[model samples]
Target: MKPSGSLLKIISEDLMPVTEIDIRALAEIYAEENVYLSVYLPVSRENEHVNRVFVNSRVGAIKKVLPADLRPEFEKTFDMAEELLFEPAVSGERGRIIFASAPDSFLHVYRLAVEPEKSLVLDTSPFLLPLARLRADYEDYGMLLVDSREARFVCIRSDIAEEKKHLSTDLMKKHKKGGWSQMRFNHLRKEAIKSFFSEVVENVQGTCDELQTRGLVIAGPGEAKQELMDLLSQDVRQSVLGVIDVAMDISRDELVEESDSVLHENELSTSKKKADELKNAILKGGLAVAGVEDVRNALEQARVNVLLIVKGSSVPGWICERCQNLQANTRPPEQCDRCGGPTSSVNIVEELYELAQRTGAEVEFIEQRDFLDSDDAVGALLRY
Candidate 1:
């Protein structure tokens, strides 16, 4: 029997791979942790991307497969593993397996991701092509923030969301006394919002043109966003999905959490609101509507792109004489796989197990400890 999704995972025991790989051709490979595992799967989406996607910033070495001459050794590596391969709906010259890991089944979910850049530059997109075409590929959508004194735009992967302004910052840089200082800082904030949006128009619009999508978000603090809406070309504004009301101190990190907190209060960044919705859905057993039955159906159809289940909820299906919670089955014929208990006395009832059984899914269980604490993990993405 295939192991539960909980059994397969990948964790970076070497957290400094970025710096190490960038500085050295290949950093010393570390032994895999007991909790970590990795896989390769077919690629989807774009066939062209940047070469530097996964090279640690310091090592500067892009991920490259064994040269053509090394095919003999490469095939040997695959033969050594207990493996299975599924082609699914791949249409490109290459395919990719998504490598994800969870700590103890759920606490921290690790996605195969390209590191974010500090500049409003979408440098990572160009790097995904070769990487995905090779074995050590890591590509996934992400967000970017573009700012100018007059506008601000938040590009989520490709779709563009913007906020622009003509707020007068020209008035405040003079006095550090009294209300004047407070007034000046507010003006700087307002001007920054405007400039951010202008850059968004130049960046996100140029990237997603070929992709058919809409409802991109535009957000940030102050009246600049309202001003940006007024300035968008009719063609651009029509694609906007939401404008939130939130603000944050400038951030150095480009992850969604840092930028999102500021925009959560605005009418532009809806990350928080959508996160709440997904959480509500998951809690309502929406994720396990048919439990294993639904999963079985999905597996048969090969429609399961991602399958998630809460961890530690796994239990055998034996009727325990002491507690009548679960009906017992196979009273004594089989051996227990996990606890070595008599198979007849225990019953299996993990929500994920049933889900996995039904779906033939490559599973990833989030241990209670690894559960994503934020909505970003499950939030419905808004695109424009």
Candidate 2:
């Protein structure tokens, strides 16, 4: 089975390749008390040099946190993580490693669909917001194609459509009878149409519920598609994105090709709406904040409900291991602001993201820069 999104999963010690259960277990342990180390390494097919480059750069960063006694143990775990790349089935465009040594030493590694900007973070809590964001962006869609005698149901994910069910009425091609027999035949055909539509609705409902389909598309040659749409429940109808006039007999490749532009436009419109919400909130003040420091402060208090980060932005900062305080100070003091304990420097931008996850705030990467000024690259909508 495939892992759902980027949820952390757990794997049995002896398992050669990672499993979906392992990823789920990993998400369950995101709040673990141990020092959580999240490392995102690029392993894309296009970049064969990523492994060697990341290993050299990241090994030094990981060793910086380890005391003399724990270096050997960390090295062993790092080596184990590297071994996963040699397994063809386990390799992916990106790789993630989560490690800790508090209550018990543990390390888990898994593949990622998209390459996250390479990062190595050690924090009080596991970094899960990025994974959540990634999952939210890659959506699942349901499509139903129907005509008078035949219907097909499919689920689309990552632009790939998989046929779930197909139904045919198998109505008589020719009939010879008197006037009374002709009436009866017409009634039977009507009943068959109704039955086919009812079954189609049932199958679509089941698929949507199971897969959490983000949106649904309906297509067919004639009036049956509209008639079928009218039969759907209000909740299901609201999910209907578009009804295209296409022949039900079309190939799956043709179906996807025709639907691609519509789906892409819908996604862009939804993203723009979200960006507008963030922009309006920022203009109104108090309820929202923009830029690095203000949003960081709001996140520290767990006041943020949504974090809007400009795509591909990173800033350096510090996190307090003792008090969990985060700061963007260029020269962090020896002691933490929240508690008098040693603080460590880190990528402040990434730490803010991890904090948003820990606090249950939604995160969105805004690609449209025109929504705000350049200084307002990172912003948040607040609860208070």
Candidate 3:
């Protein structure tokens, strides 16, 4: 993950928010001999006791099933997990995740603002489905709060909102003079307002681009918000999900709360719109492919632009040991079809996720399983 920058301050330097880079790095990690212990638990103050009990029971059960030689190492990782979770610094976090490997003496802890589903997985690689979902749900976005005289730009990422820039420009005040002077003053006041708005728009675009925000939300009291919207370039305007009417003096917490609704609505609408597009493409046999095998092929050829998969979907599959090619299969195969290399068992959905990341394809997790009507529970909108 990228290092924390000056734009925001995290709860702690050690406990940073998960990023796409972190996910990609985790996906690449694998243990050839010793397994990695991945644990997710609700760490909210009220759940402390329950967290301890759950971890103890889960660890004991897994230890019983493990080979005698591996039990000691497994216990070591479990101990590390417990220590990290119970640290006083972890109390306020709504959730916590620990990835530990005893043999490698590796331990990584991440704090979550939102509670994740409680899960423990012992595997060759870290369990990343939860992290993937969290990243998708809380992608970075920009919030612009503006009035005729001032503008504030805030970047919201992983549930943390930080004000990045504040801009203000002076405007000519209303005068009580007679016709000629009054008209001239009105003309100058309008010019000043336009100039201020133009400056605000420039900064809005620059800040959003610098932050690489995924979406934008504009808010203001009256015509200022609409006026700023009108001044934005088409590219920046397209990134704006919606606008809100609010006073300039609104508190940061209130602004975030208001923008939350807009962000949530945008997510739902965007997902539905993409689903419809996928459906149409499939009906016409145009640029979409559904089912695991076809989607895998499209991804392998780098033809996929957007990959759609039902949330929590998985299938028994194989990954070629030599080629790393993913194939979904119910039955085991001795060798890979393409490279004639030995294959290893894997979860097809997870492998598909990694493949999509490797190919720079955007992944959309469909919450409604029946949206695509495919048994494989996966589809792709292709570039070809």
Candidate 4:
């Protein structure tokens, strides 16, 4: 059985957000070497047969897109991917295959966790909408499970949770009456508790910083849980969603369940808080922009530090075929505003997300649209 704390941790780092450099490198690839192929297949723990069927179908699609000259390379990569697919999936519900062969003699392949979607694309750049959406939509959080004498720190990123730190204190043991009696014993125990809590705070702070955790969940038995919350620095305290009361040694399944619940709650709450911030920024005419067009403009300029979209909101727009500049309007202009290049219609939401990925901006989907009431369901926090 998997350890309780490990139940929800994503074991693989490949599913984490694709970096800006990776996206830029793909974008920079010459069109003559347009052999980049992206394949997406849906997989699940409950149905191996279904996964096989999906892979076989996508493989057939891949063959149709491959040039005769690339057949050998495609075949080799497919065989390796097929072997891994049949060997039981590592985790996650979707499988993504990114295969590219270029003149630089760079042959690359990646099998990653993805949402249920099927697509086969051949272009100079890999089709990244699915990957970007998966990375943006899913969340990562830090969880601190503690009791009077023990604490566990774990990071849950994109549905995978793993314990990063586990600490137990021998300070819980009974003390002898010889050392200045109960008063001294009590004093020493208090000091030890303080020290332990201090260490936990330090470790959690470091982990949260490293993981770039979006939120935090504090859980465990008794007053220690609350004590830890009180001791957290302001920055850490703001990241917390809420405190959950569970035994320090809670079962992995139980921990996963509770942590997910609290974290989700926190996400909703955080969305509201962020929405308010965006609203204030817009009102103050500070380093913020709202409305689809303004947000798109800010993103095009790489000014967005935080991109906020109302949940389930989308706007149809056009993108420059040559320059990839986004225009949040239905009517395609005769030429792009930035480069006078031809524009083609595309989903503005998707284009915005891909642009944000390239700029290393964080994207958040806000459930409460009220905060964006006059802003057309989109807003951004600008870096400048």
Candidate 5:
């Protein structure tokens, strides 16, 4: 599975009172692009109770969270009278455990005003996708058993001895005594590389094997990676989700970074393979239809994965030829409260319903701006 979030970590904010949670300041939380959840509470929270909500699960996802009481009430807003099912708290009964996809804190604030209903909605963001993206970590951790020229392995459950070198002749002297070579430097280099890998693999394996759940492993900036990856089995080598390409002195710190780093890259899909599919579909043209007729036909068969119809910002009223009924409001009319037919001139939404019902499939109707995407150009997830 791909990493569903970019920056996944926990952060806390304290609001002493309304004096502290300014709408302007709280607004900043929305800036976080991949904020899966934001738990807020007042600054002087004295409640001893702990409350935990599951943001993720192996089965699938929980679409929303209800108060200890009822489902979410979308119409409520700040400075309003209604008691929202659950207002964003500075702290939950439990410490705020956030699962996010970005590194910034401002996103925690910005999301409040931007969402139609942030609470009880569970974790449903079109942007937040499946967990399969992170499966690469399986390959990354596989490096533990790799063998190489430098394999004087050590198995330590924990504990790393820290040694600081002045980077002077003293350091060189120690190297020389170990046959680290002022003369057979090649052999010395080989041993040094081996030692580093042994230390790394033991440490890596210890942490990885101990984990109750899959954790992120970050490796870079040292021969430990080079030596280990080289010696690792082919299958293990491919397990790495990424190589930071930068060096670091400590593997532990890198592990945290890797764990928190989110993969923003999304894989291409059949939906996205727009240009090629359109080219093929056109070449294999069928019973020729265009305009409303073509769109209607595709809808009738539930063959449209996505339908892009040409319409303007607003739809005008239509007068039915049979009943002489005039379409009313653009939003949603009284449903022809008269003849019990459609009161408003049905727009793409009405057609969409018809199309979906005809074929037993449902898809998104992205705005025209979204159409510019090659995948959205024209293709339907045909209904069988």
Candidate 6:
């Protein structure tokens, strides 16, 4: 199986490639003790020494706060992280994330093409908000470049565009003799083109299914692109995000650049559409809820169909240790209201994001927009 996005598995003992499955597994892990240590380190050939010093300082500070019995285990996990982060083989990666729990005998390291915010957190579970956001930003898209004679299918994930398949069809040349023979040739050419388009549509369906692409972009010169678009099945047509009029022989770099622009525009459009849906639902008091508390409740009940949040927004809150009840508050009570248990400070936005993922609700991070900025920074569309 191909690794998702530009993520590469670091070559080390117990280090595995980061994929959606890995992220979900990490997110599911929870422990009563705060043994999980998650570290995001940004490294490059030019700043290796600087990153090492930063890691050392962070590790020293973390160790000072740990209990005497857990200090040794924490140090061991940090040592493993340092070895993986500074390895010369992975110097090409822009950053790395390591999740280690020595007490649980678990470790995972991932090399990232994009630089992540440097952070070190010791918690009951892995800090996965950054990874989740990165995964969201790098969702896969399909590109189809077609002309009357040929078609090329490319699967784009992150910044990489890889050609998945190519197809070509032969048609008879136009007859010079303007007579019955020419009409017959014309008829045969039209039939051949129709057959070829049908084949292309079938192949597109197969390729998209195999690659699990989230969206599709059609590009080519002249009318062939539109012809193919008209022939797409209803299911496939809905996935069409954009169309580009470009030369059939466009360079790979240009194709990727153009496709990236289309995908980004589609994302913004989709975000706005969802925001409008949420606003309309709220005005009608249908099945939508806004604000951190109500959205969290919807997520917990698995009634959320889509969860919308403003990018880079956070709400200070607390999660009950015993019942996992989340409450958004500026000042957390000493004990949980639902169950008289101790509470720990948590970022409610991050908690809601993870909860939405776990419950199979689509998460949409809306960029700074007037619609979302005017009211509560978080909202959800319900299933009921």
lDDT of each: 0.33, 0.65, 0.77, 0.67, 0.31, 0.78
CA lDDT of 372 in candidate 4? 72
Q: Which is the winner by lDDT between candidate 2 and candidate 3?
A: 3
TM-score of each: 0.31, 0.73, 0.84, 0.70, 0.31, 0.83
RMSD of each candidate? 17.3, 5.7, 4.7, 7.5, 15.8, 5.0
Q: How close is candidate 5 to the true structure, as a TM-score?
A: 0.31
Clashing pairs in 2: 8-23, 8-26, 8-27, 9-22, 9-23, 9-24, 9-26, 10-22
lDDT of 3 by residue, 1-384 (tens): 121233112124243444522676666666543367888887666777887788788887888888798888888877777777776544336667778777666677778656778888776567787778777778778999999899999887666677999998768564555645766777888889999999988888888889888889999898998988899999999999889999898987788788988988898788788888898998998999888999899988999999887877777877775677676776548887898875667888877887787788998887664646536778889999
Q: In model 3, where is the ten-residue run with the lowest total lDDT? A: 1-10
The sequence of per-residue lDDT tens digits that candidate 6 reaches over residues 13-130 is 3222233336654555666556778888776777788777878888888788877987887877676666777776343366678887777667777666556788888876777887
Worst 10 residues of 2 by lDDT: 14-23
Worst 10 residues of 6 by lDDT: 1-10
What ranges in model 5 sit over 4 Å off?
A: 1-219, 222-224, 249-262, 265-384
Question: For residues 62-173, could you state the per-residue lDDT of candidate 2 as single tens digits?
Answer: 6886678766755665564555543342332244444443323455555543454566554544555455445545456888888988888887654456788888877665
Candidate 6's displacement at residue 50, Å, is 4.7
Stretches > 4 Å off in candidate 3: 1-15, 90-92, 170-184, 300-302, 316-346, 369-375
Between candidates 1 and 2, the one scoring higher on lDDT is 2
Positional deviation of residue 276's Cα in model 6 after best superposition, in angstroms: 1.0
TM-score of 4: 0.70
lDDT string for model 4 (1-384, tens) is 111222212223255433211453443332332344555555556656876776677668768866688777666645544554445565543554443433333344444544536655544445666655555545677789998688899876555567899988999476554546677777888999989999999999988998887778898888998888878899999888778888866787677678878866766777788888888888898899888888888887888999987766667777676777666757778788899876655667766776776788887778746557533867899999
- Candidate that would win on TM-score: 3
Q: What is candidate 2's CA lDDT for residue 12?
A: 28
Kindly state the number of residue pairs that clash in model 3: 0
